[model samples]
Target: MKINMLAAGLLLIGVSLAAVNMYYYLEGTLSIQQVKMDSPLPVKVTEASSDKQWPLYDVKPSVGEKFAELYIPRLEQVFPIYEGTGTEVLRTGVGHYIRSALPGEENHTILSGHRDTVFRGLRHLKEDDELVVTTPEGAFTYKIYRIRIVTADDHSVMAPKPRATLTLTTCYPFYFLGNAPERYIISAKLINKQRVITWNPSR
Candidate 1:
């Protein structure tokens, strides 16, 4: 009886610790989301600049692969972005589509993020929302087209239906009490281009 009680106590303690850790992790993640995004460092991509080729070290297929900046204008916040191509980064911020490659790649360039942390503000997006991706090379603007929901395992949802598309995915049923079984997806398209104001790196 004493052994059974000890085991139960241990299990309870384990569960409690897990909850506490999750709580702290979520708090930190939200705090990060509140930070201003790192503004672009000045680099021009002129026809002349494109003439000079640079060596590619880490050949990432998607935009989120490298140190790129993403902005959801509606949110009024931009945070440091990390790659999300594999299972390792999926739990963090927007992930790139492994098969589709980087943003502006042929066909669809996909990205995924945690609805609650890195992408919690996504729920606030509306039609015609402006999503911007600023790379070391150039900045591309995408117009919000639609929002959708699919089953958790619905891989088809990420496939590009329209050419030159950008897909964003996250867990669905934002208010669910437990692990969600659905997925939320957002689709947008490249619309405008602009030269970002460059400045020296703060850090």
Candidate 2:
């Protein structure tokens, strides 16, 4: 009986700690500095012989893992982005399309967030607006060029482009209370990138 009481106490302590962290995150205090890197992660993740190159990501991420943070300076908002599109992942933060290229890749990278939560402020974005994606590997900057509405079945949202592209999707009718049939896409392309330096000669 004593062992059971100790176990319960430990569990409560763990839960309380987690709650405190989340409180700071949602308050934008802790999340603001969670990801530190050089802004605009370098593009061209893959090797290229003569300019035509494949997209590559410096960081290798696992499914449903929190790998980066998405920051919108215009909105003064920051949110976490996980590596997979799991339902729970979306509930907690944005989700990266597993099949899409990672940040800094010279191709399309797709991202989705729930309109009611993480992406509620996305609709305010406009052309020429800038956003940043910060990962342990590096940081990427993109300038918004296109914002439109499409049917949820639209595959173009995931299409790769000749240049570096970033696509953010959220359900349409931002005020809707439930599953939305339409999609709102905000497409941007890489303007600058910085690669994370992993080598340490001093070590």
lDDT, candidates in the order shown: 0.63, 0.74
lDDT tens readout by residue for model 1, 21-131: 697557536534333445443334332123212212245534344455566767765544456556445444556666664554446867777667777777888889988
The C-alpha TM-scores of every prediction are: 0.72, 0.70
| Strongest candidate by TM-score | 1
- Across 114-150, the per-residue lDDT of candidate 2 in tens digits comes to 7766787888899999888766555678999999999
Residue 82, candidate 1: Cα error in Å is: 3.4
Q: Which stretches of candidate 2 lie over 4 Å from their true place?
A: 1-59, 197-203
* Candidate 2 lDDT for residue 124: 88
- Candidate 1, residue 123: the lDDT equals 83
- Summed over model 2, clashes come to 7
